[model samples]
Target: MLCQLEDDWTLFTLVFAVALLVPRSPLRFCGLVAALYVLWPAFRFRQAPPWNARQVIRPAGDTGSPMVSVIAHRGGGHDAPENTVAAIREASKNGASGVELDVGFTADGVAVLMHDDTVDRTTDGSGELSQMSFFQLAKLDAAAKHRLRDAFAGEKVPTLEEAVEECLKLGLTIYFDVKGHADQAAAVLKELYMKHPALYDTSVVCSFEPRVIYRMRQADPDVVTALTHRPWSLSRFGDGIPRFSSLWRHRWATLMDVLLDWAHHHLLWRLCGTSAILVQKDSISPDYVQYWARKRVALVAWTVNTAVEKQYYQDVLHVNYMTDSLLGDCDAHY
Candidate 1:
């Protein structure tokens, strides 16, 4: 217990720092107690040995190439209808080493590929995604809202099973991005990994929520896992919760972001036994890259689109990244 506490001393330090911010002595005491109670699980955590991330995320058929490995964001959303099987195939066709796809459960509890809580954004259908059955989702055209809709018309939202099969068939690595439904998503992944043990090598489950990654490890420790983070993400307009309107609300968000960032950097990785961090592209820097390198954590940047940006990540950072389109800017001579 003492050894564990020594390793996680930073967590207690952060908690105490947050507690000290409460103006009232009685309330601060109560809040600190409550916070410690809530975070007790972290105190008991013993990190598992880190996975060999380079091997796990290596592109299929890779012949010791030195170029940065690229993953298709939402299965190359910019070129194909996002999250559809068509998009997955498009990613493979465009030479992506892997595809990052979102997974959400339907009203009937069937796992399917989707990004938003509602189908309004990606499909012609207008309704809550969680309220719709898979049968209903199947009928909606996923490509309806895309600029290239005509080219990819009649594309149906694919099930998680179908997405897995297609990715495995194409020898593409899979990054299952789960937004919520921790237990259910973990159960589904556990089943998939059981059936396809190779997933242990070629895939990872990632989420912004630590509980989701915790659940994935609980369900099956063999499955590789990563945590997604965007610094100041909690305060970002339209990205986190609704904008922090008032000054106090904004300040509170800033504080929360600091704590969250600290946890992402220190506390949660150890607790979750994460092998990598999928960070926003803008946050990647030499200092940041070197820091994680010291910890032996693989860094993967997301949504890198421009030719210049891709070249920089490849030649400078020399790290893996995800892009919205694997086609455009890909043919440029670096």
Candidate 2:
């Protein structure tokens, strides 16, 4: 409910304006106080960014503490099936320093690694994940449609515990990408951290939803958190809803996107207590990077696949990046 209010910039602006401009003195004073409370988080800290760039932790097996700049997107989906244990293993075997794992819940409340709301795209099943139990999910072949299906024919959907154990055993840094269920996810992560305290340094909980990060910090202040952003996300590349909607709805969504983009750049990071920002690869450049750097926030880019792009992110941008494959044309030599 709080996150919804924060994200509704249009409503807030209207309420704020009316409250301050009302002829009643009591309402104007209340409005002024409420405005300060909302703005407090932005000014509370002297340093804008929480994580120090110099102290960026390395994957467990690496020599000397040089940063692990290359991360496997969806556990190196190009090498194997995405979000499967096989994919995670492929990433480590091929020299990726880290892997990004998606977390979603089943009907039985089991947290598992899954990128989409449905199993149709990656598995042999054809239904919403929330409607399926862990038993049903466990029977489906997660790699059934992959190009390398023959090699990973029997891959099963891995639970969050299974994925985390595999990543830890392989000494790979983990990025837990939560898509929804903010409070439930935060509770699960808090329990995991309690069991494996090392995750405090080896893993980060990241989400495009600011509410997820906010809830995470509220649940466990010590957990590392990051905010993921892709400019014009809803207006352009998103789940197909906006594209199939009415023209007027699309225009309203585009306007909202612009407002949200400004909030992401200006207030959301601080408001959510994010340590880093995971930006879409296309929006990254020297100037954009400098803007975040001036405020001391470490920037990481996503879906950088080509060798040239990898090299540029390394040599030119000097930032960490996530890629689909750790082999073929996208290999990054550690």
Highest lDDT against the true fold, candidate: 1
Model 2, 1-334: lDDT tens digits are: 3433444554457567867676677866787768766876454322222343234333322455545468899999889999999999999999887899999999999999999999999999999999999999999999998888999999999999999999989978788999989999999999999999877767888999988988888888777788899877776664334553578878977898898988787677767767788998888999998987665567889988898888898788877899998774744221
| Tens digits of per-residue lDDT for model 1, 29-113 | 8877787767777543333334435656644335665456799999988888999899999999989989999999999999999
lDDT of each: 0.84, 0.81
RMSD of 1: 4.7
Model 1, 224: alpha-carbon shift in Å?
A: 0.6
Q: Positional deviation of 175 in candidate 2, in angstroms?
A: 0.7
- Each prediction's RMSD to truth: 4.7, 5.5
Residue ranges of candidate 1 with Cα displaced over 4 Å: 1-9, 12-52, 58-67, 238-242, 329-334
TM-score of each: 0.86, 0.85
What TM-score does model 1 achieve against the real structure? 0.86
Clash list (residue pairs), candidate 2: none
